[model samples]
Each structure stands twice: as structure tokens, then as C-alpha cells.
Target: MTALPDLVLFAKYPVPGYAKTRLVPALGAAGAADLHRRLAERTVGILLQAGAPVEVRFAGAEEAAFRQWLGDGVRLIAQVEGGLTERLIDAARDHPHIFFGADTPDLDVGVVASARAELQNHDIVIGPAEDGGYYLIGMRQARPELLTDMPWSTDAVLRETLRRCDALGLGVALLPTLADCDRPEDLARWPQLEAPGRCA
Candidate 1:
């Protein structure tokens, strides 16, 4: 039998003060925590429904809170202690892993399936966000340099990652762009996106 493709997601415990810090100003700490929980659940549900071998790499100061939110039958691991780039590069070392931020509730399972399919033919696949950052990144193998010195959490991230791919002569595939629910304006769309336990 063929080995199942791995789809790893990066997540945090959705704590009040430490999660989604960028939107905390608009959402307030508690509200931001709620949003993070809902988004993480939706992302996990979608990936699980897609029938992929999914792993959620949870990294944050609060491990117990994260453990409680995780349901049964999913692989959970603590992210290696480091900067964002270091953790991601470490995760990518294992499989043709795909990493996502916890904020993109609009990401569909088909996008992930498409990414895996493309990985069969390409070295790297990225789902670009409308906000100038990428929503998804998948690679056939870990290329530590791709994550080492790039400007993260900025508009230049996707551009710089692509530049690195070119420098290494890696084949690239771009997926359709999507919006991430990271700001006050994005809250308008939350009503339509399903959040089973929330007022969606």
C-alpha cells in the first residue's frame, strides 16, 4: 500500500493574551481567544474530513489548554522550541508537510487536496493569501534555507519564499488565493463560515 500523504498544521492553544496578537486590539483578548478557538476547530475539521493523515503541531506557552481542545484520533506534537522559522523548518523535515496559520478559516479541503496532488509534480506549492502573506505552504522535502533568513509575518514573505525556491531550482505551484480572518473587517465573514459552537 502507498504511504498516506502527511498534512501538518501549525497551531496554538488559543490562549487569551498570547494567541492572535495582531487582532487583539480590535477583538479584545477574550474575543481574540474565542476567534482563535473557532478558526482552529474549523481548520482541523476540514482537514480531517478530507481523509488525509493530519497532524497538528501545537506550539505555545500553554500546553494543557491546547490538549483539551484537541479531539480524539489526531496526531499531536509539541513544536520544537524556536522562532517561527525554526519550528516550521523542523516540522517540514519529516514529510511533504503543509503548514498553515490558525487564522485562515476560509481554506477548503479541496485546496489541501490540490496541494498534495501538485506536490506529486512540483517541489513546492503555496496558497497565497489576499493580504500579501501566504495562507499555505507545502514542500516535498525540507529545505532549511527556505525558512532560515526570510522576513516572516510581512508582505514580503511570499515573495521572498518564492525567490528562495527559484534560487534552489525547485518547481513551484501556486494555489488560488484566500482571505484570512485576522482583522476586524474579516469578522463580517465569520457569520457565513461555520463555527459549530459559536454564533455563526
Candidate 2:
């Protein structure tokens, strides 16, 4: 069997007051953390069910806790100290990788498969998020600089990333846009997850 490309899920340890801060005003610290945990767990479950080889690259928690939370049979890597861009660059180096955030519950197996397929022919593949960031990014080869010095949490992220790709002469493929759970307004977009106790 051909070796599968790496699937990396970038997440923070779901700690109250640290995880999903934007949603705290609405969900409270503990509630927001619970939601974060649910989303990350759900994302991992979806990929595992699809039999996609995955690695959890995380910060703010230890491996033992993550293992207990996420269960066995998954590789866990501690994120190095840095901003999101720096960590992503380190993870994507030296391998073909498909990277995604844990907040995007709408990201299904099909989307991930599509990204892997596209990476076979394209240098980069991206799934645009409704909020102007991307939900997924895949690269056949390490191109860390492509992620550097850009707007991190703004609507222009997708556009800026594409612009960077162009400047680097990287061929790109874009997948369907999806919504991620972030701000309180975004909760309206996911009715199933909006109800109290639903995410738990």
C-alpha cells in the first residue's frame, strides 16, 4: 500500500480561559472550552472513521491528557512555541501535509479526501472558510514561507494566502467554502451545535 500523506490537526488544549476565547462572552469559559473539546474530538473522529492517518499537533496541554481526551491510536505532537504561522511552518516541513483547524465541524471526510487528491497534482490546496480564513490547507512539499507575514485572523487571510502562493509560483486548488465556529454570530450558522448541552 502507498504511504498516506500526513493529516495534521492544529489545536489548542481545551482549557477554560484559554481555548475558544472569542466565544467566551456567549458560552462562558467552561462552556467555550467544552465546545472546543467537542469540535476537536468530532474532527478527529471524522478523520479516523474515514481511516485517514492523522496527527494531533497541539499546544497548552500534555500528551497524556490528550491521549485520555482523544483516545489511543493517534500520534500526538507538541506544538513548538510561536504564533500560529510559525507552528504551522514547522509542522508542514519535510512532508506532504494536509493541515486544518479544529473549529470547523463542517469539514467532513469527503473534503479531506478531496484535498489529498488535489495535492497529488497541485502544489497547494485550500478550503476557504466563510469568515475569510481557510478551514484547510494542503501542501505536497514544505513551503513554510508561504504562510509567513500575513493577516492571521481576518477575512483577508484567504486572499493573502492565495496571493502568497502566486508569488511563490505554487499551483493551487480551492475547495468549497465552509463555516467555522468562532464568534457568537457564527453559532447561528450551526444550529445543531448551538443548543445548550448539545456540544457536550
Candidate 3:
């Protein structure tokens, strides 16, 4: 069987007032944290079922909690102290990797597989998110400069990343855009959350 590509799922411990803070006003701190936990669990489940080489790089949580949450067969790594860009750059070094956020509930394993395949022909692959950021980013090698001093969490993220790719002479493959639940309005995208007691 062909070796699976490296897949890194970025996450944070579902601590109230820390995780998913953007939605705290609408969902309350505890509610938002619950949502974060469910989303991370769901995304991890999808990747695990895909049977790819998967690892979870997490912040604010103990390794034991993650092991128990994700179950066996998945590697867990603690995120280093730094901004998001630094952490991501560190994870991408020395190998081709698909790094994804836990917020994208609509993202599936097939998209991840496609990214791995795309890396064979391109130096980078990015799945754009509806929020103007990206849901996933994959690269054949670490290019920290591409992500340095970026306008993170802004509408410029995707555009800036593409510009950086051009400047670095890296060929990029674009995947279908998806939605990430961040604000209260964005919750409408996930109909399952509308049901009573779901993601409560």
C-alpha cells in the first residue's frame, strides 16, 4: 500500500473562555467550549476514518485528554509556544504535510486526500474558507517567510497567502472553499447544531 501523507489537525483544549472565544457572546463561554470540543472530535473522527497518517497538535490541553478523546492510533503533539504562524511553520518543516483547523465542520477526508495528491504536482495546496481565511494548508517544505507577519483572521489571509506563494515561486493548488463556524451567524451553516441538545 502507498504510504499516507502527513496530516496535522490543529486544535485547542475546550476550556471555557479560551476555546472558540469568537462565539462566546452568542453561545456563552461554556457553550462555545462545548462546540469547540464537538467540532474537534468530529474532525478527528473523519480523519481517523480516512486512514491517513494523522497527528493532533494541540494547545491548552493535556496529552492524556487528547489521547482519550481521539482514542488510540492517533499521535498527539503539544503545540509550541508562539503565534499561530510560528506553530504552523514548525509543523510543516522537513516534510510534506496537510495542516488543518478544527473549525471547519464541512471539511471531509476526501478533500484531505486530494490535497496529498495535489502535493505531488504542486509545492502547496490550500483549501480556502468562507471567512476569508483558509481551512487547510499543505506544503512540500516549510516556508516560514510565506506566513510571517500575515494579516491573520482577516479577509486578506487568502489573498496574502497567494501573493506570498507567487513571491516565493511556489506553485499552489486551490481546493474547494468551505465554511468555518466562528461567529454566531456562521452557526446557520451547520444545521445539525440547530437541533435541540446537539452540540449543547
Candidate 4:
């Protein structure tokens, strides 16, 4: 039997003062959190269109809270305590799975399809974010070293990850560059959140 494709979504629980903190200076506390929740919802809705099983591994909230937010029907998994890399490692069990965070509001099914298709030939696939980070990562198997300690939230993230992939001899495929909502300037990427001073 063919193995099913898994899509792991790493998301924050949208708690005020915890989620989308960088945007809080502009969107305020509750607004930023609310916006994150909406963005995550949009991402989940889009992923569901791919007709593949999506496991939502979340941080900053409990299972019941996630169910209440994303719905009881969604497959919700709590993220293990640690930094981003460790949490990512925890969710790397599903073979040929593509994992992404909830910050990219415009994520669509085509990118997902491309990632899955690219994984057929490449050992890993990564979608670069315009901000120098990555929007998604697709892997054929768990490769913890590929996700080890490194500079995160910087333009060097994508570059350093590629370097590590080379060091590990993992063939990687690159996807189209996308944007994620993490700061006030990044809000411009999404139309609804682009109005000046709206969040301030």
C-alpha cells in the first residue's frame, strides 16, 4: 500500500503576550493574538483543500484549547517543550511530510503539491520566505541535524539551513519565495492587515 502524505502544521496557541509578539507593538496585544488565530485558521482551511492528513502540532496551549479553536475534528498534537528546532524534530516522524508554521497567511495548496512532488526526487524541499527565513520544509524522513541549533528569525536562516543540508549530503529542492507575518512591516504582505496605524 502507498504511504499517506502527512502535513504537519506547527502553530502557536494565539495567546495574548505570547503569540505574534513582534506585531504587538503595532497591533496591540489582543489584536495581534486575534490576528494570529485568524491567520492560522486560514492556513488550516487552505491545507484541508489538499486532501491530505494534516497534523497540527501546537505550542502555548492545551489539546482542549486547540480543539475549541481549530475545531474538535482537527488532528491536534501538543508540541514538546523546547526551542523551535526541538519542536520541529518532535514532529518529524511522518515520512515525506511537509511542515510549516501559522505565520504565512497566503500559503496555498499548489506550494504543498510542489513540495510533495519535489520530495519524490529530492531528500528535502524548502520554501524560502522573503524575510530570509523559510515558510515550509518537506522531508522524506526525520533529519534532526538539519534542524539543529542555528540562527532563527534572521535572513541567514535559509542560507544556514542550506549549508547544513549540504554538510549532511541531503539533496534539497527550493520552492518559490513567500512572505510570513511576523512584524509590523510584514503586515503589508496581507491586504486586510496593511492599513497604516491600524494595528497601532
Cα error, residue 143 of model 3, in Å, equals 1.4
- Rank by TM-score, highest first: 2, 3, 4, 1
- Report the lDDT tens digits of candidate 2 across residue range 81-112: 88888898888856678888899878888898
- Any runs in candidate 4 off by more than 4 Å, and if so which? 194-200
TM-score comparison, 1 vs 3, better candidate? 3
TM-score of each: 0.89, 0.94, 0.93, 0.91
User: Candidate 2: what lDDT?
Assistant: 0.86
Q: 2 or 4: which has the higher TM-score?
A: 2
Tens-digit lDDT string for candidate 4 (7-105):
889888888999989999988988888888888887887788787788899888778888888885468888898888888888887578888888876
Estimate every model's Cα lDDT from 0 to 1.
0.79, 0.86, 0.85, 0.83
Clashes of 3: 0
Model 1, 1-200: lDDT tens per residue?
33446778888777799887767777788778777887888788878886878888987745566657877656888899889888887787655777777788768888888987888788899999877889988887787888898887788988998888998999999999998887777777776433436733
Which pairs clash (backbone N, Cα, C closer than 3 Å) in model 1? none
Candidate number achieving the greatest TM-score relative to the actual structure: 2
RMSD to the true structure for each prediction, in A, is: 2.4, 1.6, 1.9, 3.0
Candidate 2: lDDT of 140? 83
